[model samples]
Target: MAFVNPEREEIKGLLEGNTTIAVVGLSDNPERTSHSVSQAMQQRGYRIIPVNPAAAGDILGEKSYPDLGSVPEPIGIVNVFRRSEFTPAIAREAVAIGAKILWLQLGVYSEEAAAIAQEGGLTVIMDRCIKVEDSILRPDIRRI
Candidate 1:
């Protein structure tokens, strides 16, 4: 069977309830989409946790973790910026860390990853941009 993302109300609920997001493959470079998206989310009051081996110390004013396992606090969402092929492994890790949501950025989708995350009891969203969703679903949130 094919995978389908949650409905608009469900996605809105996830965004409304979750505050902390772990951005996998987040890059420190301002030119990267991950950086910009995360920054936007942060401006809207979501805590962005940067997870990238290549980037340590701080990216976007938050400490960078090597992987999802190393994040000390509980993560609300695992927002993946990696390619489709890389998402399944990230799904597994997000499950292990008890993340409530698995969000694949626009243009990034994998049926295998969605299945894994859904089976692990996560709210899965694919081929969508969180920043765009937030702006659309929650118009009260100001865009920076």
Candidate 2:
């Protein structure tokens, strides 16, 4: 069967329930989409964990981890900014680290990865921007 994401309402609840987002492939550069989006989420009261292997230091004032498994705290979501071709491995890592959600950023998706994440008990969201979704779901609320 083709992969299907959770309903809009369910997605909203997912956002409500999960406040910590581990961003895979997050960039240290403020000019990057990953950086801007993650920063926005952080401003919305969601904790952002940077998971870039090549990170020079922290991103957005939070210590950067090389991967999801390396993150010391529990992760609520794994938001991926990497290419579609790289998602399956990231999915496995998310699953391994017990993340509750695997979110593929806009224009990035992999059926194989989605299936892997779903089978591993993670809610899978593909080709969507988490910051946009959060803005749509909770427009009335902004932490900062």
Candidate 3:
């Protein structure tokens, strides 16, 4: 079966309820899309938790964890910036960490990943830019 993303209203409500995001494959470099997107989310009042194996110490101001399981606090959303092939493992980790949402960034998509997250009771959104969705759906949130 094919995978489908949540409706616009559902996504908007999920974003409104969750203020924290765990960004997997987040890069330390400011030029990377992950960094910029996360920065924008942070500016919009969402907490950005960097999850990367190679990132030096921190990306943005938050402490970086090598994987989702390493994160200490509860994760509201697991936003992945990795390639399509790598998302299944990320989804498993997100499920293990009991995250509510599994969001695959723009150009990233995996049916297997979506199935895994969905079976684990998470709302799965693939091949979309979280930043763009937030900007469009939550117009009340002002950028700082």
Q: For each candidate in the order shown, give its overall lDDT on alpha carbons.
A: 0.96, 0.94, 0.94
| Model 2: residue 113 alpha-carbon error in angstroms | 0.4
1-144 per-residue lDDT for model 1 (tens digits): 898888999999999999899999999999999999999999999999999999979999999999999999999999999999999999999999999999999999999999999999998999999999999999998654
Which residues of candidate 2, in runs, are more than 4 Å off?
Answer: none
Sliding window of 10 residues with minimal summed lDDT for model 1: 135-144
TM-score of each: 0.97, 0.98, 0.98
Q: For candidate 3, write residues 66-128 as lDDT tens digits.
A: 889999999999999999999999999999989999999999999999999999999999999
Ranking by lDDT: 1, 3, 2
Supply every candidate's count of residue pairs whose N, Cα or C atoms clash at under 3 angstroms: 0, 0, 0
Candidates 1 and 3 compared: the better one by lDDT is: 1
Clashing pairs in 3: none
- lDDT value for candidate 2? 0.94
Clashing pairs in model 2? none
Clash count for candidate 3 is 0
